[model samples]
Target chain A: MTAALEARGLRREFGHVRALDGADFDIEPGEVVALIGDNGAGKSTLVKALSGSLAIDSGELYSDGKRVTIDSPAAARALGIETVYQDLALAPHLDPVQNMYLGREVMRSGLLGKLGFMDHAEMKEKTQRAFADLGATVRDFTAPVGAMSGGQRQQIAVARAAAWASRVIFLDEPTAALGVVQTRNVLDLIRRVRDRGIAVVLISHSMPHVIEVADRIQVLRLGRRVATYDAKQTSMEELVGAMTGAISQEEAA
Target chain B: MTTATEPDRDAAAVDEEKPKSTLQRLVGAQAFQILGVLLILIVLFSIAEPDAFLSINNFRNVVVNVSILAIIGVGMTFVIITGGIDLSVGSVLVFSGVVAAKTMEALGGQGVGVSIVGALAACGSGTLWGLFNGVVVARLKVPPLIVTLGTLGMALGAAQILTGGIDLRGAPTVLTDTIGFGRLFGQIPYLSLIALAVIVIGAVILHRTRFGRYTYAVGSNDEAARRVGVRADRHLILVYTLAGFCAGLAGILNLAFFSSTTIAGQSNTALNVIAGVVIGGTSLFGGIGTIAGTVIGLFIPAVLQNGFVIMGVQPFWQQVVVGAFLIAAVYVDQVRRAAASRGASTRRSLFSRFSRPQGARRKEAQ
Candidate 1:
């Protein structure tokens, strides 16, 4: 099967620091691929580059085997890519429904739509359906997402990306701040999203979670992809060794 | 583990379906609370001067006088909702009125044609100033307060230079006669009617339109809005420009009502409108406010001044009262924001429920 998203020789630099040095990545359609790295390992830089939030120094990206350039978040979105950053990127003052449809609001029909009036009822209904489908417990649709608990906010951020992203969704440390139950819920949500035939790229530091939800694991060290392993076939020790530079696939080969 | 989470999920579902109580709903509504305050003040003033303050003529005069401020307050509400301040509004108003009055004088006509030209000149000048402010604040990345403050001085200075320190008079007899004092059916002043229309339209746009949602989103979190593909910079510029447009509109209204540019009359206008917007429950921190709240807030000071005059209290006391109210309103906003950030429901009083300690709120994963 063709990879839903593919990148080759991705390199980004910030003055003296090379954040991404000739990194390569690919994820098959409908698969959960976890991108693991130590601190300053270029996980976020790679994700940002792929999601069109940050410009890279050099790279080539392929979407469904076709070359594409994503220079802005909007461009990435148009190419059916969505990202949930570590910050969640939600307007704290807006409610869940409003947040879900922030830039892409559902407008009223005819004259009202032309005048930029949003169809609140339709947006509300759609948001409700999305939350229900994800089994996300977001009570009080009227309350601002900032006023919600961390877990609920996480669900909102994830659900928002899942609803709009038709091809691939990139989640950066989605479960970092979540509790055990919320983490499980998010893992289940990822599975359901994959079951819908969309690729999911998860960036996480937690090895056990990487092992549990990921079908394949890719490790980055010193801003380069050091190893790739079938999640079920690789041991946690080996993954940690790859991340810490104790085990280099290049040297082993 | 499944059983442990089941009851929690069920409880959340139940909570979602539970209907809000009347008191709860009332407390949640900031506008309603402000309206109540306005009504209580009205009652007190009426009781104090049954013959003077309670009369229709007094009410009509008060409303007519506040109509210009109300028009400008509509724009201020929008600006504040985006976490921005436009101190240049009063200056923009003065400058626009000067330009409009000059245009009407040069046209040398008291006909409706002259009035139309004068109104356009006013709106055009105001829009230019607004666009300038927008470009500076949005694109150049200057803080709104400083940019508007600089423009405030510049705009007022430009008006002074254009007129050479004298207020321009003679605003076309047609404008002053018809739009200034003309009453609808011999009761409502034309100025008040125009202001009312602006208020209604402004309210609808802010509450029911995508433009308004973008305003809130940009104010709430600029970076977040941008990340979601919102053109935040463009939106900020638009919002500031809208404010300038409103001030310009108010400038024409001011000229019609006063029959002069009133260059020196609007120095306190920006502060007064900002006070009223805050009193109406619009947060200075942005991302929350309403036109209705601003109307009620504008009335609080207007009514206070009108009441004190009739009640034999010095009307200067109105400033003191308004100043105190502004601080009180902001304090309430801060407290509410604190509670909200803590994930507490703002419907109840802060001390009503004992919140869990911060560390305890985050449970460990099993």
Candidate 2:
């Protein structure tokens, strides 16, 4: 089967420094791929481009082998590509269901049409299903997300992605600021996403977690992909050397 | 003696939200202050004019007298809830009245079509001025208070220029007589009934629709709302437009009440409308208020002034009392905010304790 997400020659630049100077990465329909890089090594640049928050300067994106251009966040969503940023970008005062169905509320009436109301029942049912899939129970459906802990909020964010995503997902430093238990909860969620036959792209600084969860690992050093190795074959030291541009295929040869 | 640390807190936080909720329902709400004042006035006034002040006709007269301002206060509620103000509403009323009367005079007296055109022109002109204020504040990024203040001056000048400060005396009597004097449901004034109808529709628009939620959301946290794909700028524009429409209707009602349109009504209206809005329980800071509070707010002055006339109080003293009420209401709001802040800081302290280690690590987090 074709990979769920494939990048061919993705390039991006910020003024003088090249953040992403032609990169390609892929994940199979149910596999997890880890992208590791040092600070300012273009991890965020690639994440922003794939999430449709920033335009790619020069790149080709293929999902299930069909080329596509994502001009907006909605367009990326249309392709079933969900990206969870570090900040989570959730409305703190809005409940989980409200945060989940924010922009696309399930309304009974057509836009500017008769009835003039939102269908709260349909939205509640759909969100309940999402929560069930994430293996969590929200105590109060109307309680705001601000009242939730870091772990619960991440679960809601992941659930929101899985509810609509069909092909691939990206997680950007998802464990940042999370407690040990919270990190474990999110790692479990990442595994669950793959178990559902969806490809997962993980961006992280934690090398140990990467080696544990990733089927394959890709390393970027100053915007260029320097190495890719099967998780079973590579060591943490080898991965770290590739990530910092210290290892070269020519040297190994 | 034991000493206690009350707490250092963010006092302004609590006052920033709409108070139409359970907070306003609390006993000792400022709206109840008007009722206290009304009772005091009744007790003092009846001793002086025992027969006259207690008469039913005197009660009816007071309700009728305050009807104009109360009608306009309904419009102000919509404006203030969106965290904006309309200073030009009074001027719009005057300008509209002039247009309506001038239409009657120029149309050769009270024909049905002439009356309809006059009403539309007056209400329509007020709405047009309101739309101008909304566009400047919403799209052009001008402050609401300043834009409406500018329009207030412009509207007054336009009203004066339209008539050269002359009163349009010969208005169509039929139109005014029906609206001002006709009884609805056997005893209710026709104008009051119409005002009631407008208020019901307005309250529904503010409380029951998707439009209402966006209004509250924008006022609450604009950036958060926009990030969630809520078209905030567009929603703000719509809010201002709704305020303008209400202002227009208030002007038309004013014209129908008084046969002659006076340019001076605009002078006191902005302050009065804002005072009435805050009097009801909505916050001046934005994000938390309701039409119900506004209605209660409107009646405070209505009942107070009614009690004053029964005691033969001078008309100028009315302004003093209203001013005092405004200052007192603000003071109460300040006190309420202070207490709420103390509660908030206590909650924050509890949270800080729950995650003390996290706090220590956060400082070294870089």
Candidate 3:
């Protein structure tokens, strides 16, 4: 299968620190890939670059093999790319529908233009489907997300990504603070999207989770891709070694 | 054994819960507190001065005077709900009046359509000042309090310059009498209805719209709002702009009521507007407020002032009462914040019941 998303020689510098150094990644369509790294390993830098939240000093990106530069977060979103940060971008005081429709609401039919209003009914209907398909049971759809469980809220964020996006998704530590059930739910969601021909790049520190959901894994160390492996070929210890800059070919010799 | 144990317990819990009645949940909501306070205040005032406090004439007088302040306070509620304040509103009010007065003067105050043109021109100037304060606060990332304070002086100076540091006299009488005295809904003063309409509209905008939700979200936690892709600064700019426009409206109302620009009218307008917002129960620190609360707050001082004047109470006592009210409201707000935070921390575990699976697992395992 052709790569749905690819990053070539991506380099980013943040003042005195080099966050990314010519990192290259290629994600095939319908693949669940984990971009694994320890803290400060340029995982976020890569994520931002892909999501159009940060600029790269050098490199090229391709969505569906067409070269592209993400100008802004909105631009990235427009190109069927969505990123759910570890700090989920869901607004607490707003209901899931409102949070989902932030910056992009379905405008209702109106006359004289004065009656312009949000087409909440349509948004609610679409959001409900995404939640139901994902097996998220939100008892109160109208409850402000602040009142929802963390897992349920995460589901809403994922649902938001899934509903409005079709090409690729970046999940940043999606199960970091989730319960076992929620972890299972999110892992299942990862698989479901891959089944639908969508490419997913999941960022996670959890070895077991990466092993379970990812079809491929790319480990980053000190702003470089230390290694890439088939999910089944990698072990937790090996990944850990790569992350901590140990167990390299030179180190082994 | 696990199934038998869980099934029996689950059934019992299901029977016990029945998904909680809507009324019970609603009665325990945050908005209920406002209703409770309003009821209590009504009862207390009725008992404190039965004849005067409950009279129709006194009520009309209270509403007419308070309407102007409430008109501005309602907009301030939106600004405060976004974790921002617009102190320049008073000066914006003065500035707007000067614009209207000049417009009226330029029209010679006697043309067939001068009132219409002057009203629009005056209100537009106020809107512009509001937009200025909003833009500076939103785009410059300045602390709203500081920006508004700066604009307050600037707006006042501008007003002085436009009117040449003197009260603009002989505002068109038609606009003045109509705004201040014309009956719109049966017998109520037009100003009172206008204030009511503005407050009602503001309340709907704050409570019902996506913009309203964003304001509350920004005020509650700005980081969370930004993460949600909310243009926090942009929304804030709009909020202050809306507030400034409202301030201008207040200025027009004042000009129409007083029939001229009082170069110093705004010196106390900000004080009264902020005080009214707080008195109505909008937390000074932000996140929670209501137009309904502000409306009540605007009336409290107006009614008190009217009552004192009628009862032959010392005029100085009006100032004293207002000052005391300010102190008390702010004190209550601080206490309420403390209590709310404490309650939240204490109730953290209760909410984690389903919200965080990890927390639940850890708690269960423990």
Per-residue lDDT over B83-144 for candidate 2, one digit per residue giving the tens place of the 0 to 100 score: 78888878877877877777777877576678788778777777788778877887899999
Give the residue spans of candidate 3 off by over 4 A: A112-115, A179-185, A248-253, B1-31, B110-112, B162-166, B209-214, B217-233, B279-287, B303-366
Candidate 2's C-alpha runs over 4 A off are A25-39, A82-98, A109-115, A135-137, A143-221, A225-244, A247-253, B1-85, B167-171, B224-228, B279-286, B304-366
Provide the lDDT at A135 for model 2.
70
Highest lDDT scorer: 1
Q: Scoring only the second chain, what is candidate 3's TM-score? A: 0.82
TM-score of 3: 0.85
Clashes of 3: 3
Model 3 chain B poorest 10 in a row by lDDT: B342-351
Q: After superposition, how far is residue A165 of candidate 3 from its true place, in Å?
A: 2.2
Superposed Cα deviation of residue A12, candidate 2 (Å): 3.0
Top-scoring candidate (DockQ): 1
* Model 1 per-residue lDDT at B310: 90
Native-to-model Cα distance after best TM-score fit, residue A246 in candidate 1, in Å? 1.7
Ranking by lDDT: 1, 3, 2
Worst 10 residues of 1 chain B by lDDT: B357-366
Number of the top-ranking candidate, with TM-score as the measure: 1
**Chain B of candidate 1 versus the native chain B: what TM-score?**
0.91
Model 2, range A134-212, lDDT digits (tens) per residue? 7753445664465455666777888787777898888888877665555677888888888999888989999878888
Clashes of each: 0, 4, 3
lDDT at B184 for candidate 1? 88
